[model samples]
Target chain A: MPKGPGEKRQWQFLERMLLIRRFEETVVKMATDGHFRGHYHLYIGQEGTGVPAIAALKRKDFLATTHRNHGHILARGADPGAGLAEILGRATGLNGGRGGTIHLCEPKLGFLSTSGVVGGCISLAVGGGYACAQRRDGSVTMALFGDGALEEGVSYEALNIAALWHLPVIFMCENNSAGAMGMAKGGYPSLVHASKNLLLIPKSMGIKSVRVDGVDAAAVHAATTRAISLCRSGRGPVFIEAMTPRWAGSDPLWPELATGITDLRMATGGAVPTGKHQAWFEHYDPVLRLARELANGGEESVHRLSALDEATRKRIADAADFALASPLPAPETALNHVFVQEASA
Target chain B: MSKQSYAAALVDALHDAMRSDPRVSIIGGYVLGLGPQRTLTDRLKQDFPDRVFDPPTSEAGNAAVGVGASMAGMRPFVDLGTASFSYLAWSQLTNEAAVAHYMTNGRLTAPVTFHMLHGVRGGGAAQHSQSPHAMLWNAPGLEIVAPSTAADAYGLIRTALASPNPTMLVSHAKLLGIETEVSEKKSAIPFGVADIKRRGRDVTVVATSLMVPYCLTAAEALAKDGIEVELVDPRTLVPLDEKTIIESVSRTGRLVVVDECPLRGGIASEIAATVAERGFKHLKAPIVRVTRPDTPVPFSLPLENFVTPDPEKIAAAVRGALKAG
Candidate 1:
């Protein structure tokens, strides 16, 4: 169902998701081509969750993300070229090529940054929210993490503090079913069970909690809108569990290779393959579903999407060229920036 | 002259820093209460309520918030009620504050001052009491300061507030009420530089924080016995004043390091290793260290005292070094 009184926002949400999807697809291809060297945790299957969650945020609000944070970075309004260039390790990147994909940050845009360590950003976001509340800046902070981060003690501690202090922090959990190779069901008893457990856990700690169907962009957007409104009105620390799935194959594709030949054949065998109770790509591809929905909307929407895809592709290519041309950091420069200099005369 | 305690000296330091730099802010728990050493927050809050923040009982979150404020160009003095509580904030101090500059390759800086109160205080048992200087000293890219005197506490704290790197000032709860004539100047006692508390030629006794007073007492006692001993106070640990330590050891050819931290991989061990490696040829005796045994500080007064390095221990270690010499 469409969210009432925010038709324009729905379109904006779709645009942001499209941007993230196109950008990530381009990044996957670049990584495959060896242009991007470091570990890239693509937010391919989970763009719907991030796009709408970010839509709930004001421009001045702050956010922090985990290693898999390309969607959050884009939603926070970082220049796509700068983000792409950073991931590619270019001088023109957000952190001047110093921080690659795992550490992409745009502080000016209120995106505090990303840390490769799981659940580390949770406390940082709580702190940021506390600072904002102390300053009475009316800005909320969103901490975006994966299901893998829930097990970390720091995340729990952060949530407790945020709740106790009534910090304007939104804990956005992107439950994408897997942490690397471990399935949610195998690692956690069950994703649905874990989600329910988390819901009561936050409420018991005096935090407001919600669960949303992350695959449905509109549902994610509606939950975010409510959470953000409550936070802005001085009634939060809120918890959101976006039950999304990993629609695309994990980046690098090398890890999937180890899953066995049968699985691989089933995954890539057909365009819209339907077998004995085994629905194929048609049921799992997030981008394909989005494209089909847009195509059904009108010929004009399809044309606009194609233009967006072309622009995003060109931007990615240009970023790759820029990154390739940039020089690697000098060995001597390694010791630099360990400490800031005392303010001078 | 009016008498005052060590805690009062720290409050004075906080007051002096706030008077000098408008940007300086203090955040901690029970800082606004009339607890033992009065309250650093109570006095500052009366004077500058906006600057002195009494945060909730969230040590890690508050520390990280202080870090964030520092990143936003504010000089924040974060107080972890006790040294034991600092363990909860290790990740923030080590990961974010310490590594921000290096990770960003000089693009960002977190100039946060963490003030932690530690050391055995009466019957304050295992959970409440712990000397965590060793744990903090192990973390690279952080400036660790432990001042024994009120004057140094005032001076060094002023300097740490102005520093661009993440700094930790571990104050001993036992030393808070001691009074000394602190200078009004806002001068910095440079980090990694050791002070010669007492001059002697027979041997060099290196001490830190609360151990400095014990070493001084030991030096005086040894002086009466005609065993002249020098006392060296290494106010800062990280930028360890290796030059001063080596110079003193080279001249005396004997060394005794008194550290409150446990023996295993403690700051004393680091100092001893540095001297042994650098001043090996000049050494007339093996370097000895007087520190707590490799175990947690206990609750019993006698046991805790025995566990902590004292003047008698330093004096004995000095005599042993002299005998070896």
Candidate 2:
């Protein structure tokens, strides 16, 4: 069996990351093809932060994420077919087509909520911490949010409460603003906070704070594992700020495949990328970076990585087909679950 | 039977719930009330030292915490102090808690209870005095309970605590000191049930929350003037007892609605619209509503009194309804 980073387990990480990368690509294609309506966020570039971080969580541990939550759900082992169906607003979706893209969640796998509102998941995860404390189990809650969430006022309140109570919560902030183009430049909005460093916000509240490179999957995994251990031991809450350079595809107002579909051959040196977005394929692409790391072993590793990508692509394509075939919810059932009658049952 | 203040009854209900259910906990320090009610909260904190939490002034955050905790196994009762302050927590209450179950496609439920002391209490002014329960009623999926008497307070709060859906238990600060007989063994009161405070023949006066007691007093005054009135108090606003109100209107052709909320799009407006739509054939005269004028509650005591609906105002509305027929 393979061992260590860029080995067997890292290959599994590569598999999960590939699933997310491919799933995101399919979502963009479906949206562009007019299969769905309304604006939806893409998890294209943040796979490094989500995959490794979520892998550190146990089955019983609770998680709450933000609008860009498709990768988080898939990383937690949610079936891509159900996830894609939910995004397509089909009856077989994870939330029965009611939640759609923004509110997609899997409660059975211990996801508390995938809030559409920014800064909404922080307090919810703190609550999960309180529940875990009450159970006296080793379970912990992880709040995965973007850097923009720090600007909202509730984050301050929630961070303070977690520190005071010493709750078992890991506040994982995926700060993707290092190379992000702001709305002023026709891209998504960047973090707007007075503090020079984001980590100071949590540290000021007496929370144990740390920073890590989000693009480095190994570093992210190590940081997340340490944070979860600190939380499990009742060391209050830990605030992790993972700094990542925003992908070129996310530079525009709406996400576009600027660098085009990943070739996977570029990581094995059979092909090369040469364009304005060449830097993305060279450095920022987490999928290519991990693949290149594994392929560095030998030519055998190259064929193995390519084969793994082929299988992941096939699985995602099948999931998309399943979602496309799923039926829309019946019209007469619109008013169901409005209120829980006889809730005790 | 035991005589207890309305506030005391609410405290007792919470105390009993926490004692019986270990998963039930209270947030936001002391529950807002007078003298003995505050003492009861103190005792509650002492008994459940680990459960009660006194977080800093963070309505939005703590409200969301209650929502999150409720979904994750614990039932939390978040005290939001004054009704006006609920504005800070409006998003958490309306967006997150109210829509969780439906949005999640029945995969999750937020069994959280929010307590707020509502309505005008003397010189509470614009910031302190408010009855936003009507606004919350506009948001679907929330169970709104506003009790008018001590016994109703005891029974209704228990039901709210036991409910699996998010519940808003609105208590009027003005009604706290009022005392009435409450059975020690009284069970939980079901929602959507209206209690007829007084039965009469001429006019049906539908009131809610603080307006119920004023309407009852007006019913007695109207009786002396040979204008018999049937007073209906809707215990819960969301699942309103429309059947009882419609049946009462059937008995008495004249209808009068009274409420402490403002006249524009208030509780009175909703009840009047319901009657006009569903029970239109039974009406002999145009319905009259005694409600607070569409203005911010003034700081001056006399201005506050001038704007708010009182017993005399309700009595005049009932007599006018009878005369207009």
Q: In terms of DockQ, which candidate is strongest?
A: 2
TM-score of each: 0.85, 0.97
Of the candidates shown, which would achieve the greatest lDDT relative to the real structure?
Answer: 2
TM-score of 2: 0.97
lDDT of 2 by residue, A1-345 (tens): 255654766787889999999998999899999888887887877888899999999988999998989989999999999999999999999999998899989998889867888989888888888888776788899999998888888878889888989999999999887788898887888877787799989998889999998878889999999999999999969999988888877777888887778889999998897888788888988888888888887988998988998999999999999999999999876788767873321
Chain B TM-score (model 1 vs. true structure): 0.95
| Cα lDDT of model 1 by residue, A1-345, tens digit | 243555456556656766776677667667778886755676766877888788778877888788888888888777888887788777677777778888888877776535666767787787667666665768888889877677667777778878877878888988776433344323222133345356676787979898887767778878988888788878988899887665425623331211111121122222334553233135444444445555454556556556755665576567556666767666666556555652210
- After the best TM-score superposition of candidate 1, give how far the Cα of residue B297 lies from its true spot, in angstroms: 2.6
Cα DockQ of the candidate 2 complex: 0.57
Q: Assess the local accuracy of residue B186 in candidate 1 as a C-alpha lDDT between 0 and 100.
A: 33
Lowest lDDT sum, 10 consecutive residues, model 2 chain A, at A1-10
True contacts kept of 2: 0.63
Q: Which residues of candidate 1, in runs, are more than 4 Å off?
A: A1-16, A26-40, A55-59, A79-100, A178-195, A218-226, A248-297, A342-345, B1-3, B16-25, B31-35, B38-40, B45-58, B72-75, B184-188
State the lDDT of candidate 1 residue by residue for B1-325, as single tens digits.
3444557667777888888887688877554123466545477888977777667677777887777666655678999887888888888888777776666656666778999887776677787778887887777668889999877887788888988888999887777766655555535677767889989999998887888877888888999989988888888887778889889888888999888787899888999998988889879988898888888778888888778788888899999999996
Give one digit per residue, the lDDT tens place, for model 2 in B1-325.
Answer: 8888887788788888989898888897757644346765777888889889997788888898888888887889999988898999898899989888888888898889999898888899999889998899898889999999888998898888888899999988888888878887856898888999889999999987788888888888888878888999988987889999999999998789999988889998999999999999999999998888999999898899999989998888888898896
